[model samples]
Target: MIIDITCRTDRFNLSAVGPHFINDCCFGEDFSRWLVGALRRTGVDASVIGMEDFGWSNQATLDGTTYLVCVAGNSDALADNPDRGEWHVMLERKRSLMQRLTGEGKTSATDPLVRRIARVLMEAGLVEVGVEA
Candidate 1:
């Protein structure tokens, strides 16, 4: 079945897209949901980086479709190999740097306390970080 993903361009512009995505991914077929969840706070920053790296703009349009340009790692690429420590570490470093530069502290779409609580649940076997691979 096709997902109901839409080009909610305005939400991304307001830095809300990342937050919105965290929950949508939890139950999706691609079981490596944490990859997307981990990125909840950094998506906006990635978008800005895209502006420099790919000459992507903070704003863009194609064939009358407008979009807020955000750098979400490719789902297809990630789904193939989900748990590489190197990628996690690299992304964390980038996220740290971006936070300092932007002066916009990172808060997961969920609060930090909530994330910790959920982590505990997953660790205790009440939940699982499902592996799509």
Candidate 2:
């Protein structure tokens, strides 16, 4: 199955930090790096893509299965101003039996790394989609 994990940020001041600074120096870079490393440790191939406006995507492959992870902000907000927006962390699983049965699908939530990531995002004040805050 293909899993997509997306992380969205709460509204913040991008003007003070700048998109590049935030992307590289703040949460975005660290989270993406940690995620990729954690997945690799699990024997999965993973990578980060499109690092701009503190929004990016990650790709992972394991056991012939592919997953896409994304960390982005609302398009309208990003287009207008980097700040004054919320971030989204979307986890999407493709072609999975769970998805076939449930429209939303499932992920490696049981995995320690996955859970840790979720918790960290939550601590950072980001909400998980489909999950009660």
Candidate 3:
């Protein structure tokens, strides 16, 4: 299965604080390390994708399946707006083997693996939304 994960934070803006604060925040170095570790524990080979305009991500693969886990600050401002808080996290599974086996259909957030990943993110205090099929 291919998992595409997007974590949106509430009132958090990594870009405004600059890279220096990355290691000092929850959605920073610690989160990245923790996520990669979690994936590894699940028997998935994972690696960091480094920083992005808003946050960062990690990539993983298991049984020839790919997983892209991303966390970013959401805002509509042309520039980084730490003041514009985020409200949700979105996770979608793409090119999934499960979908193929079950035939093309609506995405189900109740999938075991999806739940597992959601649990992991929740453990970090994120509010999950739009994860349901």
- Name the best candidate (by lDDT): 3
Model 2 quality (TM-score): 0.43
Of candidates 3 and 2, the better by lDDT:
3
Rank by TM-score, descending?
3, 2, 1
What does the lDDT read for residue 33 in candidate 3?
65
Q: How accurate is candidate 2 locally (lDDT)?
A: 0.52
**For residues 1-133, could you state the per-residue lDDT of candidate 3 as single tens digits?**
3334445553444444554544433344445666678767877687787765446666766556465666544454435455444433233345667867877633355555566666666666765433533
> What tens digits encode model 2's per-residue C-alpha lDDT throughout 14-128?
3344445535323344456666776676576788764655456677665564556665554334556655444544444445666677755445545333454455556556555
TM-score versus the correct structure, for each prediction: 0.16, 0.43, 0.50
Candidate 3 residue 34 C-alpha distance from true site, Å: 1.0
Query: Each prediction's Cα lDDT score?
Result: 0.26, 0.52, 0.54
Residues 15-88, candidate 1: write the lDDT tens digits. Answer: 11233244322112121133234333433222222222211223322233223322222122234344211111
Tell me the lDDT of model 3 at 5: 47
| lDDT value, residue 29 of candidate 2 | 47
Clashing pairs in 2: 4-91, 4-92, 6-89, 6-90, 7-88, 7-89, 8-87, 8-88, 8-89, 9-87
Runs in model 3 lying further than 4 Å from the true structure: 1-27, 73-113, 122-133
